[model samples]
Target: MKQPNEKPTLKTIAQVTGLAAATVSRALNDAADISASTKERVRLAARQVGYRPNRAGLRLRTGKTRVVALVLNIEDEILGIVSPLLSGVAEVLEASEYNLVVIPETPAGDPLKPVMDVINNGMADGIILTRTQPYDLRVKVLTDRDFPFVTYGRTDMKIKHPYIDFDNEAFAYESVRRLAALGRRNLALLAPPPHLMFHRHMSDGFRRGIRDFDCMEMPLGDIDLDTPLQEVFNRGRKHFLSTHRADGIVAGSASASVALLAGLEQAGATIQADFDMVAKEPARFTEWIRPEIIAINEDIRGSGIALARTVLSIAAGHPLQSLQQVLFPSD
Candidate 1:
């Protein structure tokens, strides 16, 4: 009998099940050649002994890490979207033997270094990429290497890699249509960074909504979603000081919307009285802070889970074509 405090291993399971260590390992891994009865016996013994696979040993034997690398933006983490996204990915990984490793990178810094590191070092079995551009070099490199990766955002590269993207076009159109229904003719859009594919989608939707609604564009100055929160606040402080006015505003994120609202309130501008704002609610906190501002839900967590599942399937030798998913926003 094993000591009560002793950690369980394949040898321990084999000792308990009266099987060879190799057979126990093959059964634990679900090897095709292993018989069902033997596998069930080994698994039952492993469960009884609380046996767990050692990742290092597994990698040495199979040349696979059983890990997934998640590449997220620093800004997204600062804005509080990282927790739920990570939770969702970890939720899926918990069910399997895989683990999650998040690698945060600056928007302006080299995003390809971590990816290349993973490829050269065999650091992970799969990867999750984000901040996808229309002509993304990262996507091109990964596709060229025939790596197992899935982007949380869409890309327009000729290669067909796996992806799970939000419906930015639909979000923009719905925001505009909702604001228009509220009788706001002059509108402005707080867009995501211009270099991303989602920005182009939003721009297309914004133009279409403007033309369809016969409304005038109230352009917000040089800043975008990537700008610092303080700067967005500073801009809002002086936004209403001038004669300019946008009766309705649509911001890309809850953080940006709140920053704008905070500065506007500090500058003595009132919500609903001065202007109405609509923003994407990935975390569902905008209404809690300010009920007057309209909030729309974005499925950030679901996107994370979808990306994980797709990449895991691809790494397991499944095709990527059937795994592409695009989530549409509701409310």
Candidate 2:
């Protein structure tokens, strides 16, 4: 038995229960092979000794961490979207002692390197990746090493994987359609920087929307979202004023919608009259203003719950039946 007021550990339980440390560990995990009587004895002894498994030690024995890594291949400033991503994962992890470690993506770095560094160096038990490309080599890297991971987008090569992504094409198309419905034509899209899978998806969707709604499209104004909002607004105001004049505008992201509006306001433009604006993601700023903005249902909370389920499922040794692509459709 453990001495009163002493912190309980696996070793303490092993000694007090007269069982091997491995057996104590197995019992604590509720391994099916352990005899029922032995399991009961180990449990009682663990309670008396106040023993708890050493997470580090257990991982050493089983080669698992129960800790998931959220890997990004972008700068920290772009983490506004990534923050909500983690928020979804955290909601599920809060139910248990499981934890999330966020690793920021470096600018122009090798896509597979950060995660390989984390996994090979033993920093995380599993991984969650975002902004995956259509023919991304990162998927191959993870699979080659037998690392359990899930992604936030899809791939085209013949390999199967787990992922979660929004219907970017549909959402973008819908944004334009909504603007057209308001009888405003000459729609333009302010999209994220090039080279991201979501950017491609957004562009495709925006085009489809134009084709579907028979709307006239303007120049694609791509912006570096990593820059500060004030900077984006200043630049966007100049660009919007000098470049193609648009009667209807759609901001690809929630914050971008706000930034674009600031720029438009600075230029002495009124919304719903001079131009119609819709945010791709529902932004709080859209509220408390005239002409309520239309937005997509980017449920950060649902994302959290989905990530929790994916991590726990992988940890439990169950292959996700198929790559889970749960889309929270925006209205």
Candidate 3:
């Protein structure tokens, strides 16, 4: 029996259940050599004694830290999207022994460095990468090392790996088509940083939509992701005040849409009357704010779940196809 001040260990449970310490350990770990009846007895004894497996001891035995690393850019962390994504990831990881560790990267620093450190040091069993570039070096390195990793976005590089990407191109194209249908000829698109791989997809979609709809794109509306929110709003206000004011706008994100709306309101521009706007955001946000503002629901939480599952699968030695998912707005 364990004293009141002593924490319950496998040895305590083994003594209480009259089983060998090695047998108790194997049963607790669900080793194939342990019979089901013995495993049940050991589990019951562990519950009675409140025995908990030591994580450090387990790592030493299995060579697996049982941790998952999620790497994100610090700038993107401020956008208020990380919460729901994290919630989804947590929901999936809670079902297993795995735990999540977040690693934030600065804009100027090498984002791949933290990922490499985690891999080389065996700090985590797998990794989840975000804000992927067109030719991401992290993807190349991880693939070369044959480490278990999954990306939140697609890469332009030829190396095929597990990934989950939202369809920015299709969303942009549809936003333009919807605006053009409303008889808005002069249009503008608020885009992300040009260095992002998704930016290429968004730009391509916007250009194709302009050609298809026979509309003009305001050159000044190209906003980068790194630009301050207030600056984005100020730029929109200035543009709307100019003689070349666009009659319609397509914002890449809800934050961009809000900034543009604030600018338009400051300039006394009426929505749907003087101008129209469409944005990509979580469906619930647009519903709660202004139902009239057309929005394409980007499922960030779903993407998180997919990323979690992919990395876990890779870690488990399960062969999987490279996953490419694109979500559209629901009516």
Candidate 4:
């Protein structure tokens, strides 16, 4: 009988099963050399003794920490979409022994430093990066080191890396096309920050929409992503008062849409009447304020799951294709 206060180890299980410690270890790990009968007996003995493998011992033996790191910028966290993304990652990892670690980056600090520390210090086996730029330095660093990593957005660089991104360009073009169909001749786009890679894609689509639909883009349509909510409203108000007031508007994000709504209300403009508006947002947010507004749902949770799976597969030496995926919203 095992003592209540005594913790069970390989030696304990071996003693209980009358087997050598090496044999017990091999059976527990399902080594091909261990026969089926012996493996079953060892497993039964381990269960009876309530034996569990020590994580530290396993790591020392396998040279794997079984931990993954997610590096995110403070700006992206402030957008309030990180929760769902994290939920998705957690859901996929819950069934496995691996754990998740988050490293935050400041606006002024070097974003690659945290990732490098995680790799050099053996803190994590894999990494997931968010808020990728067009010419991302982190990509080159990780690639050169042969470290396993996946990105949340695409980089403009020629190097092939695994990434999961929402189809922002297609969403923007479709939004403009819809507005044109409503007989809107002059359109405005409240674009994201200039530094983000997605900004370029959205801008390209907006410009294309203008030319294809024979519509004009408002001079004051482009708004920065970091602009405060009230400031966005103020800008919208001022734009409405201008001689070049737009007949339709497309907002970059849900928060921006809220501000635009406030401004429109103040300007005595009605939705689908004075002007039509379309916003790119999560499904829940669109549902919360629907009918009056049109929305393009961006599935961030799904993106998180894809990113987690890709990084884990890469870390495990799986020959996965350099995945570059872009998800589009439903019509």
Candidate 5:
């Protein structure tokens, strides 16, 4: 009895399920008073009628936007985080009532601007941010506001909030160990930006490994993972031209890794023949790009899933203590 041109609403779902409009609304919202059977029935009717909630109306009633914002540092395509991370976040969000919103912070401006914009505009109920600093202002601001947020990297801020961090320490330490075993005495790390929290972690591990494994440190000058690939390649080319440069390098990011390798090859240094490169595999390209490179896989997809889940849970008033996780890099 419904026109094909008509759109589906709560009333349409209620009619299909033979329930009151109020009951359908409560059930759709998963209110505690609603029975599970009734909720399931309402959901089934919603599916059958192709019903979708109006975001504006839902916000007015629940005082929640039911949106989570992902704040990313828009560096070069070097890290290759956008696609895999989004895929993982989207997979989790598809099962929930919330929606995903990406807020890109360009390298030019104040890093806190995107986060502040989300807060000021009430654009999202929660936030998930990446590229943390040792003394992160963003973490401090979010904590001070009592706003729900989850970081993809850890911070040195005194106020602890929810976070899921990749273990850069282990990644550096392990790469150094492997390279040392292969008799590579001089090593260098293409670290994250010196300002980032993980840079300290990675450098600490690199230094520790050098001391423990008796390897000499070959420092790369003023270059980092966040640097543009073209720049990285240029620096790498110049660096490798010197005969006394590092025999082993811990590659920083995926795109940067490729650039460095190309630079090394262009400088007439054979990869794994004259020197070796290691990386944290943001993607599986390490296997094909250079089979010899020891690219320890970092689960970017899994990190996305964890970040999304933690942010939503915290926004729902969950405590922060149990939500923190640090994932290790592995093959």
Candidate 6:
């Protein structure tokens, strides 16, 4: 309905283009059934009438909001690395008509409930999931519902979809190799929790690096990767003082990386002389140092762009065959 001073709708476009309302609707939606000429006319008429397809109304007709939700599972403190991930997602969405909604995991709720809620409640057309585990519960829920999503990392579920992951194993392994190359023995790796799939990969890479390098590593290191903030720092501080002595160190996350540096300094270990620290993600605090600490930028924005585009294609009724895994190289 066009009010006295209101703009147009699909009905107005249909009238102006001399096409059926259904034809105008389908044309505006880029439906294949609508002829080419009719689509052009509807588009031009829409322009003249200042008409834009109401996404809310379209959702009612198509049973999809055409909105992609980015879910973050930040129940723990170490998982705060997801901040830059949203920046990447926002950049991609800015170039497209699609919308990005964030679904923050509640503290006490089931980890898998948000997926079901978004899909069943029609809050989103698809989702982009981060912090995927080996047997991710959210993936299972979304798959059972036949919903589309892209993961920040891979899962063990035999089914292939869209994903953008980093080479965690290679990065972890090479970090150790670099230390070994520098003649730094007694290495300690501050890794993510074993529950995370990448944790396993990184640990394997680190071990393989040491064995291949013939470091005679005791494997008596603290891998308190993903834990409470205070606990991780406490363990790192204690580990640096008493046992787990290492000349080379790898901090798996930003906070852990900074904590290890601070802990080592407090324990009378001088940087470069006693310990060479490497961070998995770019650290803010390390900027003020004499020599910048080596770090691997997660490129969360590029990963987010990949995820956003995949969800859009899926929602647009395109074949999912083009979807592929994107694995970044280790720095």
Model 3's TM-score against the true structure: 0.85
Using alpha carbons, what is the TM-score of model 2?
A: 0.81
> For residues 228-314, what per-residue lDDT tens digits would candidate 2 score against the true structure?
577768865775576577888877777767777778778877777778887765334355453456666566556656766786677
For residues 1-331, could you state the per-residue lDDT of candidate 5 as single tens digits?
A: 3689888877888778888999998887767799989987887777677777888888898988889999976556545888788888888876666789999887667889999999999999999998888888999999999999989999887887789998999999999999999999899999987888999999999999999999999977788877778888888888888766999999767777788888878888888888888888777886885787788888999999999989878887755557789999978
Clashing pairs for predicted structure model 6, backbone only: 88-301, 191-225
**CA lDDT, every prediction?**
0.84, 0.72, 0.81, 0.81, 0.85, 0.72
Give residue 80's lDDT in candidate 4 (0 to 100): 50
Give the per-residue lDDT digits (tens) of candidate 1, residues 28-142. 7767798978877887777677776777888999888889999888664444568778888998876555778888888888989989989998889999998889999999898
Candidate 4 regions exceeding 4 Å error are: 1-58, 74-79
Inter-residue clash pairs, candidate 3: none
Error of 3 at 96 (Å): 0.8
Model 6 score (lDDT): 0.72
Ranking by lDDT: 5, 1, 3, 4, 2, 6
Give the better candidate number (5 or 6) by TM-score.
5
Candidate 6 regions with alpha-carbon error over 4 angstroms: 1-28, 32-55, 74-80, 106-109, 216-223, 282-292, 320-322
Which runs of model 3 end up more than 4 angstroms from their true locations?
A: 1-53, 76-79
Q: In model 3, what is the error at residue 184, expressed in angstroms?
A: 1.2
- If scored against the real structure, what TM-score would every candidate get? 0.90, 0.81, 0.85, 0.81, 0.93, 0.80
* RMSD in angstroms between candidate 1 and the native structure over all alpha carbons: 2.9
Candidate 5 CA-lDDT value: 0.85
Write one digit per residue (lDDT tens) for candidate 4, span 122-209: 8888999987889999999999999899999888999998899988899889999999999997998888778778889898998899
> Weakest 10 consecutive residues, lDDT, candidate 4?
72-81
lDDT of 1: 0.84
Residue 283 of model 5, lDDT score: 78
